[model samples]
Target chain A: MRRWLARVGALTAAAVLIAATAPIIMADDLTVTRGAGDGGVAREREIRDIKSEIHRLEQRVDQLENENGQLKKSNAELKQNADKLQTSTTQQLSEIQSRASAPPSPADFMDAMNRFLGRYRFTLVGGAAGSYIYDRKSNTNTFALDLEPIILWQLSDKLLFEGTIEANLPAGSSADYQLPVADFQYFLNDYAELVMGIFDQPFGDWYEDQSPFWVNRFITAPLPYNVGSLIPPTEVGLQLRGGFQWGEMGQVADYTIWSGNGPGYTNATCGSNTPPSPLPDCSTTTALVGDTLVSDNNIRLNTHSPGFGGRFRVYPLPADSNFGRLELGASTFDGKWLDGFWLTSWGVDFNYFRDNLQARGEWIQTYRQMPQGLGADNRQGWYVQAGYFLTGLQVPLLPSELDQYIDRLEPLIRYSGINQRATVLGNVITTPGIGFTGSPALYAPHAREVAVGLDYWFAPSIVWQNELDLELPRAGGFYSDTGQAVGAYPNDRAFVSQFAVGF
Target chain B: MSRLIKFGMMAALAAIALVPLAPRHARAAEMTPAQQKRQMFRRGAQLWPIYCNTCHNARPGGEFSPTEWNMIIMHMRTQANLPPQDANAILEYLKASR
Candidate 1:
């Protein structure tokens, strides 16, 4: 019985201990299982989070790569642009240098000038002459130099102003200056023009066309158009002039009409003191030759009346005809002289040029009504001139060097005459280029002259001219009451040599 | 009649006669540039001697440049009473020849 009790108590104690230990073990096991489950869930959540993060990081890296590619493309475009700009700048610099180095062409220079000033030009045209004269009757020799300057100004397309200044210098004499022409012209159309101020009178062709030192064939003018002739060489006037094609055959016609101060008259009477019984009323007679003395006004010297004149010219042949030009002209001038006396003049002229030959002629007639019933003083004058250039002659046998010189030679001839009808006051005239000395052939009522000339042309408008003139008096002799022989003047001869240039 | 009145009448008659001979602007405008230039040159050659020879010898065309010819023609137009058409044609010829 005692052994069984001991064994049982031991067994109980052991069982109690076992039970406590078992409970502790069971609790520890449950805690371990729960911890294991929780740990597995936490690990799964972390793995999912990590996978999402990796996806986001990959997207960010792709974005960085795209940005890098864009940067590279922009940089390439910038470089191309810079290269183009540099090339363009270099080309421009070279062009500028070349332009700066080259000289401007004529057209370019003209363009530059045109920009500075409107179309304008300045030029000088003139003639110069040196002459030596030998007079037979007076046994005198004279040397003279003349200069003429012609200026033309074009104000516009239709307006023009022209002037001529003539300067004459004779050896041992004071210089004389004359304004031959100064005029303003306005074109009415292609065919008509109006001229104002002093101009060459449109009378015969001599004064208006052929009086220039370089143009005239001889040093001296013809007898009819000399300084003491019936009409003045120039006049202050208003003129209407023009030319036009007349027909389909190419004929041309020109006309000129002018109004100016008329001629004057002078009469000589015993001046305050009467001469001795044999002086024949008056010692000298006064005559009115030309009315150019009073250029400023028409009232001086009884030249109040206005003169009317006109000229008409016609060219029958075609302008391009091989025969050259043939021109025929008619002119007339009529005016009132001093004391209401009539002074009328008419002229006809012809010019023909063919090859190297030129021929021209003029006839002029004037009638001056005298005061005190002295009757009309009728005057007639005529001149014919011809010139032939040696170039027209074909001389094959001449040496080549001599041909050039021979071609420059021209021979000219002119015959001029003047007839003055008797005046009741004893017809007496004062000659030009000579003092009031009594010269028979020059001062005679009727006179004739023959002039021959030889010209050597250095250029188109420069020439050396040699001329000889013969002056012959016509009609019967006349003697003043003082027994001075006026018409008994013997024939006279003159020689003149001139060097002229027109530039 | 008074002398002035007579002269005026004469001038009037002359102007009347010249009206029909005026240049035809319409005809000139209708031509081509080349044709107009050629015609002008021809007309200038034809009229050169007729006008220039009346006073002095005709100068050579090569003596002046185009600009110089223009000035010379303007001067001669007034001095010689040349019609505008003739003057212009002469200028063209001178320039062309040079």
Candidate 2:
């Protein structure tokens, strides 16, 4: 084993020495070998070629080692970059999971709620009205009841849409439903609005404002504002109206300008003692034309030109002034009446509101040129009303709990009158014992009404209204018995009790 | 009618946008509490001619106290299905005004 190790060691040393001598031997013999004789040159050339080949191999090995070192460094760097990327991705995923598990904030819940409720809003107003009447002339008693349903939708902060449906249900008039108003309003700002659809006339408080049956002291409307009366209480129209503050007391000025389908045609027998007649032979009643009017009373010249009017109201007193709030207003309209007679109407109104006291009044006049050769005549009406709340009296009998149910006990008084005169275009009076028998003549009557009533308010929107009304007429005039016409009468009286509720 | 309506709406918006730039009274923030309340009441009163009064006259707000108004407003809110925000605004106005 020792001899073999020595021999292997000696051989390794000899090979190393030979390898070291090859490069020097190639350098020293290469020049001489090229010039030597054929046999000597062949030997030298062979040795030189071997040394050259060894030198080239050694250089190739050095190049491979450098390449190998670069490859290892590059591998290390790539692994480090891969590890960094993994760590970063893991941390990001952990952060996302942590955030997902956290509880929501109050703002998140509020935001969700806002998004849920952002679309639309709805409102409904409903109630019942009950009435009992006693007529002196007829000596009869009657009772009636009705339901009033009003619905509204607020599409947004700038838009409002509302509707109403009223029916005299208990009187067997449930099927006869009336939609008084279906309106849409767009607010332009604090001072202006655009309103359209079928709505109450913007004339006076009597028609423009919501006069709930539960609020008024009387069961019936005033003489001038009665059904089939002189004024257009409601109409389908578009209105541009608004209120503004002016003067020292923050006095407000409210105005409305509108156009709509004018009132329907009226026949000469409107206020006459003549009873109703069948169509064809009958000139339909021209007074207070509703949505459906007979051909005889459809005298509108054009769709948009049928009617146009405006009203303006101003508060003359400061808001906190000693006199409280006082308002004065005026309204006017011009339109074509039945038989194509040009008609114009004008009115003035006022209202005073103070603590426990309210007073209001209105005066209206209408003029129309008679068709054919008949001259124009003027018809006029007026009413004044006042109410005083007795809650201030603090009656000892009133209970504390009752106070919640009964806000006020008010005594009210009102006087209203109507003077109607229309010239007959032709002698077409068909009813017996009515009108000028032979010829067209002036037919005018003066009707006056005085009512004294009491209002008991169980809640703000619920009340019982009791009233005694006196009807005075001079010349020819029609009267009502328990809300039914009893023909022309000199003097008539009635007692009415009404119970109303508004939800 | 549609064209007229569109024109009217544009004009109205233009007028409104320009109106605030016009000279007016003192700012609401600068006014006293009573004055502020009065202004709000007057502004709120405009809602009456718009919302109510389709058939009859609107009863005066002064007829009831603030507490009474609260009760009435609550009933009306349910009856009329008034939006919460609008109901709140109207109640606040009535309370301050009365």
Candidate topping TM-score: 1
What local lDDT score does residue A502 receive in model 1, on the 0 to 100 scale? 85
Backbone clashes under 3 angstroms, per model = 0, 14
Q: Residue-wise lDDT of candidate 2 within A1-503, one digit each (tens)? A: 46545655664575687779877766657655666667667767678677676576567556655666897899999999999999999999999899789976544654565578675256566667777766665554666667778776766666777687867633322344567678887666655667788777766667544355664556666656653345666677777766555655335566677777775543434333233311112233443211111122222324324677777677777645676667788877666656556567888988776667778888998776654343555678788988877764654876777664344688999988767542232221221110001000112235677888888776567787888877655524322101122224446777778788866
The 10 consecutive residues of candidate 2 chain A with the worst lDDT sum are A433-442
Instruction: Report lDDT per candidate.
Output: 0.70, 0.58
Tens-digit lDDT string for candidate 2 (B1-71): 63355346435634543364433545866999887667656655654433233123355666654444554
Candidate 1, residues A1-503: lDDT per residue as tens digits? 46545655664575565556655655655565677876656655655565565565556556555666787899999999999999999999999999999999766776687678776655567789887777776665777788889887777777878888888775556887778788888887777778898888788787677888888877777767653466656777798888766664447677888887776543433322223222234334444222111222232344657887988888888876777888898888888776577788889999999878889999999887765344567788888999989995668887777888889999999988776643222334332232111122443446687889999999888999998877765632223233333444467777888899988
What lDDT is reached at residue A359 by model 1? 91
Candidate 1, B1-98: lDDT as tens digits: 55666577567846754575645557988999999999999988877766787778777677765556776787676566565777888888777776
Where is model 2 more than 4 Å wrong at Cα?
Answer: A1-118, A170-174, A266-304, A338-340, A394-407, A422-444, A473-488, B1-98
Give candidate 1's TM-score: 0.75
Residue pairs that clash (backbone atoms under 3 angstroms), model 1: none
Q: Say what the RMSD of model 1 is.
A: 17.4
List candidate 1 stretches off by more than 4 Å.
A1-122, A265-302, A422-443, A473-483, A487-489, B1-9, B17-26, B62-71
Q: After superposition, how far is residue A269 of candidate 2 from its true place, in Å?
A: 7.3
